[model samples]
Target chain A: MPHATRIAFVGTPNCGKTTIFNTLTGLRQKVGNFPGVTVAPAVGRVTGTNTEAIDLPGIYSFAPKSPDEQLTVGVLSGMEQTIPRPDGIAFIIDGTNIEKGLFLFSYFAELGLPSIVVVTMIDEIKACGSTLDDIELEHILGVPVIPVVGNKGSGIEDVRLKLTDIKEFAVPNKLAEPEADIPARYTSVRNIAANVVASPVRDRRTEFLDKIFLHPIAGPTVFLAVMALFFQSIFTWATPLMDGIDSMFSLAQDGINTVVPDGIARSFLAKGIVAGVGSVLVFLPQILILNVFIVILEDCGYLARAAFLVDRAMGLFGLQGRSFIPLLGSFACAIPGIMSARIIPSEKDRMITMLIAPLMTCSARLPVYALLISAFIAPIYIGGFFSLQAMVLAGLYIAATLVGLLIALLLKKTMFRGAQTPFLIEFPPYRKPSLKNIAVSAWGRSREFLINAGTIILTLSVILWVLAEFPRANIPAEMQPLQAAQTQLEYSFAGRIGHTLQPAFAPIGFDWKMTVGVIGSFAAREVFVAVMGQLYAADVSENDVTLREALGANISLASALAVLAFYVFALQCISTIAVLRRETNSWKWPAFAFVYTFVLAYSASFAAYHITLFLGG
Target chain B: MNINELAVGKNALIERYRSNTVFSERLMELGLTPGTRITLVRRAPFSGPIEIAYGHLRLALRPAEGDGIYILPV
Candidate 1:
């Protein structure tokens, strides 16, 4: 029996660290938080080899700074509570940035760990008209430096072969302690450049893109245009796709109703099975579509550029450029978005950002938006090139941005009075995104949402289906067909609970049946669809209620808008709140987020409803 | 003297930050030594955090925290 030699992988951001990790470990990877910390750790065992690899968060130095950097420090220091430190450390460095990579090399040597230096980006360096002298770097750093491109699996076998046999390495430590005047470290690198490296011959296309992308006004304009395109695509381009999905679900539900017995079982199939779960499943297309952009934007260097472009606006509202990373997170759900506010150095800025994050209108709200767009704002040509639905979506997204920040800024000036955090954004050199990597990330995130949606939505949908199903003791004649197939749920406690809570929602323009769906949606926003589906999926007669009809017949335009508002502004996402709990180490943050978001959702819906009603005249 | 009064190129050690108490302690823990040397890098583009190159590190301290450090121009 042989023990797997575990190697810790480390590197700085955008230096192709993950590329090396993937090359070494392949798909034998799992990512999760280090114990007591929310930062994700990637651990993988090299396939077909007796080696395990742990991918640490990228860091510029070993010293602790921000939470991200601190996380890197913890893992390297073995201070992470959950997992034991790796047996060996693999320091991944970028080949082209040999000069910048050296600092980390010296830093890791101080940890006195048996280590291997995995130099990445060799192809990039080759394209840049330079090559690495692995021997020279080894001589300088007193460590075995394996100069290999981690992306193409080039020189990867050499790394694995070297790691197999552990040899004691000790060179008179060339590492220096933090000096008082390290300015010469910067100067010497410049001198080394003039003598050793040739004139630049690498492609300059990345710089060409960065020019407009990093421009003050121009960069933000490009970012806004990209966002506008994303919204328009989701709203209009997705319409046909969504209709296709809806029709499929409808047909599936119709088939189920016909085959099933005409009793309680059919009611459960209709209300619990179809109406509750199907409604949530219908929005998967829009959610999946939105995820495509998220994965690509993350892979492209554009997201960072987008962060840089919005840094000024963020700073004005007391947020750092880093806040943009998490606020953009609202496209998923705001709880985690708000929870991500922990990265902000200033609590005032963090709190302010947390308060506003839910306003971003996550994809969960898209179903309601799509429903509203179809019913009310359906297509009108805009500039002969755009659909009115597209325009409305663009407007909704823009409003989320503008109105959210306005309220954030206003709150800062009043209740959360505090100055903004200073911006210290790291602008990594942009590169064309990798396709396989982007696909992997999209698969990962969509899978995450699906897993969450599957379990929570399914349970709540079934629960709501039961509640809407009934009491045979006082069964009404019109609902007689619903009884023979009726299970204990028709007489269950949940049904009574829904009826009990029905009156409170009456003023807000929701029927008791809809109120039951709302109770079930508490676990997740998307569950509202499933809960609604499950409630209605039972209407399976020849004139059986359709999911769409179930929704449309039960809900008015104003109520529909109200549901959209509830999702748009409500801070009901459980995963997000869970993340927030971890980030702030306080219930206060999630509580504040929940309360404020609901206040915003409720008030906004109330206002939208009355205005909508007045216009019906 | 307070950091805000220090001239450019002056060195100051951060005593403690004040704006966000949570962040102030956090910064101190990140090696913002009370007697360490800190040189001003540059103020933010808009009136934001005052950037300081503190002891082999560059950090942007909000104005309130920027006021906590004490020093004299080098």
Candidate 2:
């Protein structure tokens, strides 16, 4: 491979910048935001014989105030002080909003950075009765205008071609800007567009949709409708796909069992690798689906609208107007939730957001909650639609959000010891969401998550299998498979470790098994179910070995209730811990989150279990 | 007061911001600059968020944020 030319991808939020990046780089990427920023940076190599592509933060302009956007300007000018600079910038302009998108391009030109323009959503432009003259644009900008229909990948190969043939160059065709006042820049850019372009007044559909969707009373109802649809999509809609994945892994485990020897090797093969990892992998479908919708909302520019629409109400919670995006992301996983906080801008506000974000009840907690509730209190009728057990799961999730926000409110009043930050939000122009863009982005993120799980989750599971699987001398051969495994687990390092501190959990009515599951969950909340699945059955996906049968056979309803309470209140995903460490640059929040969540989980579960039993009696 | 008491969607602009807050960048990113226009969209149940349109963008801004904007009618 020849020396990789420095290339950077830059644009505004939801501009399909990352999508374009992924279309270029696929899985060769790393994610980090600007230093001390939570808005994530997706750095990837568009590896080829000679070309390497770098995707930077999506910024609206070179005069960036947000730290997230600051990297955009810094990186393009070869002044990304913390990181390497780029040789060329591929400026992605939303096709329908060329005039507005040009604002940033104009900024890059003023800085004399060589840039190539890639027009995203060209299809949207045509549908809207507009056209971009790439030749004229190229002439005006003096850079090769690569007219890419980013959503269709109609000209992606061409974009790729130009990237590979990049050269060290300078821009001599940039427009000069006088003074540094930001308002002047907007005025000037608006003036520049007036001379060269004429599109019809506003699109009538926007006003039509806005009438009902943004209506006074009807507007909020519409918002609720849309959000409910989003939630249902996360839970019910993703189920079948998740089940399909679950089945494949189950079949694989069965296949392994058929050929493998039946002792330590069989147990480890069926239990540790398949069942353990399989349980975690089932959730990937939901993660991917969530990303699909998220990417669409972001690209179509409705996400900002939703943020603006709700900012007035969420602001009372001391969150920024755009907090909805990050908060919604939390429902999928807290890593993105914390990462999205980069948009908050203010140090105080951003920190508060990161602190409370983990409390949002990520989807990873759903399986554990479902497992416990189904085995314990699934009544004959649920909330009249969902199963009664499912309602409880939903209730627990909602309750966590309220209680967490309540705690944040209390903390902001005292511990934070800072004044309330003023907040504002922008609502960018409406545009058709690019399907190719959204698909590429979703696939990219899902790929990253699966990779993280493959390496981190696998290593931890192997190490955990060791902890649960040694000291053969301690167990008698005649015991049942589970009993034998339990004996070994009890004698193993993991079990001894659980036994050493058994007194602490005893108050919450936790058995050594529950203690072990909770400890294992430190790596991920979903791992709790996997641990329980392994502890209770020979393999997790064995049809007869449902979560119900496992917990039901050994533990009483009340103990099951305790476990439910434990998962509900405990913030136990290690990815969240890792992200918090990186975001806060400390061990403080994760440590605090673990300690307090354990405390809350224990107290809540203990209270729930005993109280339920007492009431029934 | 109803929106008529204020101008047609014009941002009230900041008078005095509460100190040590980092929300300025967030507001700026959202296109909530002073002298900007804000068109009220909708409100959810239980006194939830109010959706609004600003600078060709749309979202729900909390009432507290509106109050913080400290708008004086144009």
Candidate 3:
């Protein structure tokens, strides 16, 4: 059996490298950490071939400015212990800007690897009235030049065929030297471009569009409005889909209850597995919806401009403008947000961004926030267009942003004091977002969410069930079922622990039941609602009213606000801490992150509880 | 004058690098060598980073970093 031929994809950022990789690999991709570090390298086996493709992080050159970039160079040079040198390289080049691509390509060509050049953005190049002669390019570079419209799957088959014969590929006797001076290398690249690439007239349409999009006042306003619609859609658009999923799970639970007789098995199956996991699973629609908007924003090239727009505000906190992209990504989940921080060139700034990323209101917190807001705040229409609930939701996001900025400022002043890093970022030209790319990204994110539900949340749900179920408490003979259930929960281990922990949480207005939810949610912040559903004996499908009414009857508006505040500041997700530890390569920063966030959560919750009461909530 | 003092939309020729740090080296590798032609595209709103175009590449540069690049107006 022949070993799988390895091919590595290398390119400058935003050059459609990942899109082409996805097109070839489809569902065969596996995202894992490179040997010793937490930086993820996406590896996938090409279909119907013995070739595997590794999508390295998008980088400009081999001179490593950051840790993530170092991994790319290390792997390519076979200097890394775990990563093997590839047999072939798929060097992606942006079609519109051939000069910069050629400048970087010169370094890789000198490595003398069996390589092929895949030029992306051919459509964009044509739209600008330019043409690239791939035959001419191949003649000049001594490699196969395959021009591809990456998002549309054009030229993909040609790339696949070339990879199969990659070992047979010929190389020029004389290749560019890596040690050449910068000016000389650039001049050579320009010379090559001058031969095969026609200089097209610059498009003025982008300039006209940028005038409004990059305007001082209008830009931020448009960004805010875009964000507002994004959040509102998370609430409105996901409702029907969420209901459909809730009903399907409810049906499955009923079917299980009818078939499995009344026993520990039945209880465990229906309550532990279905109810516990199903409650958290219902938020999938919202997560997918949020990810779709983010994908579109990124694909359409608006994200870089957004970074440019907020650079001044971020600079005030001693953060580089590049921090904006990672922080925005945190709204979907902190793990990706933390991972995206790799793009920040400065180690200090990256660490600071990761530390504060959890402060963004992630999709996990949506279930808890929605439940609390619906139960406490009346649904009044604001300005006849926006609901009061939406306004409150937006306000919570704003509050989180303000708090994150404040913490970043404090950290910069006290602990991570340093000179601000440079904000050198590329602004790619706008294009119509490809539906294929959006679907792939959204699908990948949703799959990851479900996998978490299956593994981590599933195990925790069973443990939580056992903690709230066993030791065989005897029920009073005359009590109703709901009363008997409540009595049993109060006698169980988790209930006892909650009772013991109540005093510590009481000043923040958390009752014993709420305390139990808080403790259960340590593994994941979204598990709080599920824990409440189990404890209250409410059917998971009826979480909207059953759990809501139960919570409303027990807690005041002050307590609800405090709970929201706690989630806003608390570092509640275990995965986030684990990733932080891995990314920082030390236990110290993760420990510090957990402690500081815990203190902030407690203090803020205490203050919110008292303030709401004082304000006559 | 340094890059920060260069007016927006004005074309300039890269004179020399004022800093000898690793970052400056990286910038030079990105084709910002001496005598390269560049133009200040626009300064972001509220004193944000300066945007500049060199050849076909566009980059956003903070004022502090921009101060290290000495340029002569075209």
lDDT tens digits, residues A245-268, model 3?
Answer: 888888888899789997679889
The digit string of per-residue lDDT tens for model 2 on A1-617 reads 45677677877665656667877776566674457544456666675635556677677655566667776766667665666777777878766556556666666777666667787766655665656667766677788767667656678887887777665233637543645344555555555555444453455577677676556677677777777677667667877997799789879987987999877898788877887788778878777887888877777767766775676566566665666778778877788888778877667777777777887887677777757766776466654676565567668878887877776666667667576554445445566666656666787767766875677777777777777776554666676655655566767887787787777788777888788888888777777777776766642334467656667777877777777777777888777888889877899877887787778777898897788688771
Highest-DockQ candidate: 3
Is model 3 an incorrect, acceptable, medium or high docking prediction? medium
Per-prediction TM-score to the true structure, in the order listed? 0.81, 0.86, 0.96
Candidate 1 vs candidate 2: the DockQ winner is 2
Interface Cα RMSD for all candidates? 7.9, 4.6, 1.5
Tell me how far candidate 1 lies from the true structure as C-alpha RMSD in angstroms: 6.1
| Number of backbone clashes in candidate 3 | 0
Q: Which stretches of candidate 3 lie over 4 Å from their true place?
A: A172-175, A476-478, A538-545
1 or 3, which is superior by DockQ? Answer: 3
Name the weakest run of 10 consecutive residues (lDDT summed) in model 1 chain A: A180-189
Question: Residue by residue across B1-74, what tens digits does model 1's lDDT show?
Answer: 77767665567665544454544444443335455467664443354445465422344455555565555555
The reply for model 1, stretches above 4 Å from the true place, is: A1-4, A22-28, A33-35, A148-153, A156-174, A177-203, A239-275, A335-343, A414-417, A470-496, A539-541, A544-546, B1-74
For model 2, the stretches where C-alpha displacement exceeds 4 angstroms are A26-40, A45-49, A123-134, A155-157, A167-172, A178-180, A377-384, A417-419, A429-432, A474-486, A538-544, B1-74
